[model samples]
Structures are given as C-alpha cells and as structure tokens.
Target chain A: MTPIDKNSNMPPESEAAAELLDTQLDAALQSYTVDAPSDLLAARILKMAKATPQQKQTFQDIETGNIRQENVLWREKRYGFGIAALLLISLTFAFGTLNFAPSDTESDTAEIWLEAAADLGMSDIYDWVEGQTNSMDDTR
Target chain B: MIYKADPDQDVLTGLMSGDERALKELMRRHLDRIHRTAMRILGDAALAEDVAQTVFLKTWEMAPNWVSGKARLLSWMLRVTTRQCLDILKKKAPIYTDDMPDISDTSDLADKKMIKDDSAKMVRKAIERLPNRQKIALTLSYYENVSQRDGAEIMDITVGAYEALLVRARKTLKNTLIRDAEISTERPKDDRKLAL
Candidate 1:
C-alpha cells in the first residue's frame, strides 16, 4: 500500500489529527526494537524440526497432507473407543432381561397362600391329578 | 550436514534427523527474544521464563515442518508467546506498574543506552492500560515492526481490524501521553522525583 497523504484535500481537521498521530507513532517506534533475539531463529527452526515428524523433513509436501490425516485419525480413535463402549453398555441393558420381586410382597403372600390352601389341599389335588393323568395319558 | 545450503536450515534439518546439538543452537537463537516478549506481555520474570520454555518446547515439537514460508518463524514464535501471555493475562488480569528492564529513553543511538531504566517500565505500564486489542496492535507495530499482514496473522485478526486497532491504540496512547505531560508540568521536579 502507498503511504497515506495527510495533506491532500483530506478534511483539514482530520488531516491535522492524522499528522499529529503519525508523529507520536514515529517517536514510539523509534524508542522500541522488536528484537527477535538474534539467536532465536536457528533455535526456533531447530526446535520446530525436532518437534516435527522425521517424515516431514524427508517429505515436506507429503507431510503437509498427512498432518491433517494424523489429526483426523487421532480424533477417530478417541471417539471410536468412546462410541464402542457406549454401544456395549446400551446392548447389555437392552438384551439382559432381569426379574425382581419385593421381599415384603413375597413373604406376605407366602403365608396367606399357605393358610388358604390348607383346607383345599391344592398340592394333594395336583399330585392326584398328575397320577390319574399319567395312567390315562397314552390313550388320550 | 543436513540439507547443507543454509546453516539455520541445516541445523533444523539436523534436528529433524535427530541431531541433538541442533536443538541447542536453536534454543540459543530465540531464547532471549522469546523471554523478552514473554516478560513484556506477562510482566513477571518467572512466568516469562515459563512462556519462553513452552514456546521453545512447541517449536522443538514442530521442527520437521518448519518449512521456510509457511510462516515467518520468529513472528510465529512471538505469536505463540503472545498467546501464552494473553492466556495468563486472562486468568490473572495482571496490572503492570513497574518499568521494563533495559528500556532506554534516549532516541540518539550514540547516547549510552540506559540499563534497567524506569521510562520503558512506565511506557509498558501505560501500554498495559490500553484495551487488549489495542495493546496487541501497539506492541506488534511498535515493538515487533511486523507489517500489517504479519501483525494480523499474529493477532489472528483481519488486516482491516488490525489497522483499526492500531489507529485506536495510537490515539489512546497519544491522549495518555498528553495527559501525562500536562500532569508532569504541574508537578515540581522534586515532587516528580519523590513520586518515582
């Protein structure tokens, strides 16, 4: 971009304001130096190289494309395991039918049924029915 | 040795080839600037050291792909250091009141450069008082001398936004300096010395 002209018919007050700013900025810039620590470039390059994959140096262009692939694969592996575990838990809950009865209900009904059935002797009747059925079962 | 044309590239290539000495060379080159940038942004020597160390570690980790034009390596490092400092700033909201070390007031190159001076410290404190984006713009323009494009890259803002921030920051800093000048004029020299 070309240097902006502060004077050329640019609204007078704005132009003056711009000139004042340019002056102050020049002063501030002069006072400072963004020293990149002369040693840092080599260090950073070495550091980045060390940090980079060997495949990257040997194959810079290929590595560029592979880097994204590695990230995608890493993400897939992480979520893949999580999804697998989730599916396993869901399947177990869905397929594993369970039977349960309250302890109080079982005990309460057991005594009452025993007392009521004493007069009728349902067990004996069941045994007698089983015996007669056994004798006649072949013809029937 | 490793890709022999450029020494810096050679060292980096060597490091990629697992040559340990290349690591030392790389660290030597950037440590000071990284530390200084970190110090300015963080305003704490210890935290600056940590930021510097982390930037180097990340650099070392990213070495193999240090392709020449992917980014200006130093600016990339500065960007990393700036980000680390910003993260800390977000958590602590540090207020810098002290002067930065080795900052000089003399614009003349011939003058003996002052060491561990208060002027830069005041300036740095004043900079910290700026809005976050403005502080970044000022630092990038004044200290880093990064062109608008590189500055935008470092700050992750658009070039237009970066320019706007710089303009706003410049205005704010000028107003602040003018205010300070007025205040100094009203105070006696003895009072100024006492305040310092």
Candidate 2:
C-alpha cells in the first residue's frame, strides 16, 4: 500500500483507483447495447409524413397567409356594416313616408275651400266629382 | 484538394422539392442512430420509435427552408432526440425507479451465460437509476461516442457543465454497482470485475 500524503487531496493510489473505475465504466458502457430498430419504423415514418401536411417553410409565407386572412375578415366586416346601414336608412324612410299626417294649416285651407264651394252652390262641380269617383270605382 | 460535395446537401435539395425518395434516403442514413440514441435514453423501444418518427417529420417540414453549413443535420436530430427523451423522463419520473424489471431473459441458460446476462442487466439498471440529465450525458459521451463539445451543444449546456454531469453520472453508477455487488451473493468475482 502507498503512503497517504496529508497535503494533497488525491494520493497516487486513489488516482490509480479512479482510473481503474473509469476503465470499468467504459467497458460496461461498451458492452451495454440495445437491439436495432425495427424494419417497419422507417416505413411507418414515411407513411406518416405522406399523410400529414407540411408547414409553411419561410416566415414570409406564413406572414403572407396571415395578411390574406386578415384582409378577408376586414372585407367581410365592411360589407356587413354597409348592408346594415343601408337597411336602417331604408326602414327609416319607409316608416316616415307611410306614417305621414296632414298638418293643421293644410286642414284649415281645405275647410275654407269647402265652405267657399258651398257658398257658391257648385252643384256641377259636385256632380262632376261624383261622376269621376264612380268611374274610378267602376274601373276598379 | 478534391472538393467532395456533401451528399446531405443533395438530399436537402430533394426534400425541399417534396421528394419522397429523398425522405426515404434520409431515413435510411440516420434512422438507426436516432432510434438507438432514443432507446438508450428512454429504455422503451416503442417510445423510441415514436420519437424517431417525430424527429424525421420535423425534418421534412423544415427542410424547405433549411440553411446549409450552420450545423450538421444529424447533430440537430440528436439534440431533438435528447430533448424528447428528457420530456418523457420528466413526465414519468416515478415509473423509472431502480426496482424496474430486468431487460434480459435468463430462462434455461447455461451458468456462464446467465452470469454474463446478469452482469449486463445490473449495469443497465444502474444506468437507468441515474437522473435524466446524467443519463443523457453518459449515453452521449460513452455509448454514442459523441465528443464533449458536441454533447454540450446537444444538451444546450456549457462544456464544463456537461463534463460535470458526466463525472457525476459515472461516480453514481460506480457506487450503485459496488453496492449491488456487496448485496448480491450470486455475482461472480470475475463478472463483478468486468461490470464495475
């Protein structure tokens, strides 16, 4: 046995022991081997690659696709808003036109016209109006 | 000096053009190494195969824009395999205890054969008992014969850190084997010498 040195951390014997241990470890690692991969592994991988879609390779391609998608969404939204606005305006116009009522001034003017016609005793005008209304009813 | 064009460059060009033959050729060239590395790290043949398949699929997808001369494709694949194996080991750390089943079939064998088989089994179990990073370090440095620099790159650590991991792995493995030797009466002296 070799004498142990107090100052040095590893003596010569311990160094030799460490080397021997490393040799044994190397030998064991060399001896430990796994079986080869199965023959079907490559074939299976090929089949999977064929079935799956490949991703876009470049960042440029990915960015372009994203921009196109965004453009389509923006177009859809713009058309939707335009159509909605058009519908709202049309509904407003239709409601206003259908629900119109005669104003008080117009009603007074019509009453005055009626009184004047009565004072004039316009029987021919009345007769002509009645004849015209009868003709419209007959046509209907 | 004859400038021999890299064959992998040709394969990369073909893969970029969506050639199935190129993919097949690539697999033929590197699949065994990838599978072996994965198997040694994971200790499961099925999971190793899945990892190999996934790595190749990623290769196919990335081949179109792959730049030449940055790093060797095989090195990249090995790095991916290491990462995949680590992920798996982390997820199922509890299942890979030291008392896991032995790999060798020792039934109806001669005494000498049984002894050799037992030694190999003990070595394997000792390796499997190591932590995930240490196991990977040992596998890369010893079994795969990967250079320390390359191993560091694959593991994404500093060279000093990689060396430290490998030293720890070897020391741990040696201690475990010595402990097993003291516990087992059936291990022959010569077999013990060979294993540890």
Number of the predicted model whose TM-score against the real structure is largest = 2
List candidate 2 segments past 4 Å from native.
A1-13, A60-140, B1-7, B94-117, B186-196
Q: Model 1, which residues run further than 4 Å from truth?
A: A1-14, A32-140, B1-8, B43-46, B64-69, B94-121, B187-196
Candidate 2 residue pairs that clash = none
TM-score of each: 0.54, 0.63
lDDT over C-alpha atoms for residue B37 of model 1: 68
Error of 2 at B111 (Å): 18
Instruction: Summarize candidate 2's per-residue lDDT along B119-179 as a digit string, tens digits.
Output: 6666776777787888899888888888998899889999999999988888777766554
True-structure RMSD for candidate 1 = 12.4
* Tens-digit per-residue lDDT, A56-140, candidate 1: 4325566555455557878789899999999999887766643233355468788788668766778787679889999899778
Tens digits of per-residue lDDT, candidate 2, A1-140, equal 11111222234479866676666666766667788889999889899889876654465665566544556888889999999999999999999987895566668788898789888999688989999999999999
Residues B99-174, model 1: lDDT tens digits: 2232322232121122123344435545656666677677767665668987898889899988998887776665
